[model samples]
Target: MPNHQLLNNMTHHDVKIITDYSTDYGDNISTVMTFPTEFGDIQKEYPIFFRKYPDSEEFQAVVMLGLFQNDNLFLQAGNWQANYIPGAITRGPFAIGFQDQSADGGSEKAPVVHIDMDHPRVNTEKGHPVFLEHGGNSPYLEHISNIFTHMMDGIEVGKTMFAAFKQFDLIEPIELEVTLEGDQVHKLHGNYTVSQTKLNELSAENLQALHRAGFLEAAYLVRSSLSNIQKLVNWQNQKMQQQVTSA
Candidate 1:
């Protein structure tokens, strides 16, 4: 259970967070929600996919970090091997929370930073300080602020992008089957991807529409990112080999 509280310089003047990536900190996720805003950055390092919730017909973009649950292939020896860490992963224990505030004679939801006091990273001991000596944001806190901004922006853009993809009928269920070392077979289900055929088959007007909206390239990125799945297989092979040697 997360103990969330609005971040206050006075109340959390001594809050610090460990800047480490490891399973001990619950970084062993195989997949995470990504955004079209980050498609360029994410597609280069991780294979991107889409999935629809059981109760919702809307699609969401996701990036693959490993093959299955509890397996983060990028996590290695207390460090994340990937060059671009997902904002969700690096956000640590901070999140954007909304609070009602009066503005222009009307109340509205205002964005405020919230901290998870019970997160494993949170501490009063050594780590990146959340605030400066007295009562100001530290360099680390400033970086986290930037992350929330991009995350929020990404989410907004993603909604439009996914709507466009659905409008164009480009999202399709993917049948991904892989045979790893030692004849180990794995199949991924219930995930979606941008269909190259459908994307290419679109009318010129639709193509131009997607181009103007800046989503055509994002669709291509999702299609091209599948190549990274091979990299995952190779990494899994090496991990299995290491285990065999140590055994």
Candidate 2:
């Protein structure tokens, strides 16, 4: 169940409205809203995923929006974060990604974010899987729609959107053994591949290892992305303020 407090006070058009709802290709339920936007804004309302994942550590998701610099519309593919390469595996804007563990490789050695690397496919070969992996269902449409509706209220005008996605059930990895053309072999197991046995066992060393590996990086990424998003909001607010003052 989603936390309704997160969706309170959200509205579109300033009038009572009903929005179209749909889940992500992964079948993960999410709420979406499209609202009017100023000329330079990142288009209309916004979509927010409001699933409260049971496991805090395993899987997470987020929604971000704002007027980006460089005169570019940053969406699903081709965005700063997409190409940033958080170690390996390029990502695309607007799409959710997964980094899971391999069957043979223990969680520590190779924490892989699963996606078909660039090839002839959808949206500039951005490395997103063509179809939702077995277990990943597009979030429910109602979830997407409601979040979008609430986002307008939840998020201040002109701020880059950022939310940490989490739900063990929502993003469980589907095991698969894949072989590529060059006899290359690949396998997928579970996202958040880092073993949590230590956290469960309360092993100090394991907890330390999690912090050292990508755990800390994950925390930093969330924080940094949010910080940058705030800048976008500030920029939007400043512009609006200037317009108001001049008018």
Using TM-score, give the best candidate's number: 1
Per-residue alpha-carbon lDDT of candidate 2 for residues 203-231, written as tens digits (9 for 90 to 100): 57644654554343333333333334334
Error of 2 at 203 (Å): 8.2
The number of residue pairs in model 1 that clash at the backbone is 0
lDDT of 1 by residue, 49-93 (tens): 998977988788888999878999999777898889989888988
lDDT values, one for every candidate? 0.91, 0.29
Cα-based lDDT at residue 1, candidate 2: 19
Model 2 global lDDT (CA atoms, 0 to 1): 0.29
Worst 10 residues of 1 by lDDT: 53-62
Give per-candidate clash totals: 0, 39
What is the TM-score of each predicted model, taking all chains together? 0.97, 0.25
